[model samples]
Target: MLLAKVIGSVVSTQKSPSLTGKKLLLIQWVNADGSLPAQDQIRTEIAVDSVGAGEGEIVLVTCGSSARRVFPEPNDAIDMAVVGIVDSVSQNLSA
Candidate 1:
């Protein structure tokens, strides 16, 4: 799992059958400092939801084989998925 922010959304009318009805969002992975890295941008995939999140929303993303579990078809080709939206974050000891 990784931390990221939903930067934008992807609109694709034509995609794999397994991807049908899934909402694709463009998420940029954020560092521990809550800022995204520019070197190699990381994007997350979000399944269909009515959460109504937008750009700058800190979210949790699960990747790898776990990503496919978000859908009914576990064998779907998915690398990432937004699982939750962060309400707050606090570090006890400053980094």
Candidate 2:
């Protein structure tokens, strides 16, 4: 799983049959501090959301083998999905 922030949304009128109702989104990978890296510093990616995540929301994204767990019937084409919305995050440096 990776941490990402929803930067924007995707509107598609035409798509593959397997993606008929899935919501597409523009997500930007964030650093541990929850800040988006510079364009030259990191690659941005998109994910399909079945769970209604909006822009500016911090989200948890599952990919590859683990991504399938988000949806029981995830087709072969579904590579990513937004699994959860994070309300607050805190890191412990003393651990």
Candidate 3:
């Protein structure tokens, strides 16, 4: 899993059958400290919105085969998905 922010959305009139009703969002990777990384250092990608995450919201992203598991078809063309919306993050600075 990875932390990311929903920066924008994608709209496609012509797409795969399995993706008929799915919402695609543009996401930018977020650092562990909840800060966004430098533009050149991060890569933004489209992800299926499973949890209804909106723009500017911090979301939990699941990629690869794990993302495919979210759909019942299992073969859905989903390489990445927004699995959860992040309300808050807590980190222990002292190890």
Candidate 4:
């Protein structure tokens, strides 16, 4: 899974049948400091919203085969999916 920020949404009028009612989101992976990368350096990606995460929210994105598992059918056309919404991120002091 990858930690990312939901920057925006993606609207698809035509899509595969398996994704009929799915929501797509534009996400940018967060830096080590839990901050967004610079606009010029952003590598944005689209992820299917599985957790109902909204824009400006920090979310967990699962990629590849793992991401497809969220759908009822294993063959769903999804390479990435927003699987979790982050409430907080904590670092261990001892680490």
Q: Arrange candidates, best TM-score first.
A: 3, 4, 2, 1
Specify the poorest-scoring 10-residue window by lDDT in model 4: 68-77
Using lDDT, rank the candidates from best to worst.
3, 4, 2, 1
TM-score pick, better of 1 and 4:
4
Model-by-model lDDT, in order? 0.70, 0.80, 0.89, 0.87
Which candidate ranks first by lDDT, i.e. highest? 3
**Model 1 per-residue lDDT at 79:** 66
Residue pairs that clash (backbone atoms under 3 angstroms), model 2: none
- The clash numbers for all candidates, in the given order, read 0, 0, 0, 0
CA RMSD for every model?
3.1, 1.9, 1.4, 2.0
- TM-score winner among the candidates? 3
lDDT of 1 by residue, 1-95 (tens): 67778878888887777777767778777886688677767544554322456777887787776777766673476767777788877767756
For candidate 3, which ten residues in a row score worst on lDDT? 68-77
The TM-scores, one per candidate, come to 0.75, 0.82, 0.91, 0.86
Residues 1-95, candidate 2, lDDT per residue (tens digit)? 78899988778777767667777889988876789778787757878885789999889999886665566563556788898888877889897
Answer with 2 or 3, whichever has the higher lDDT: 3
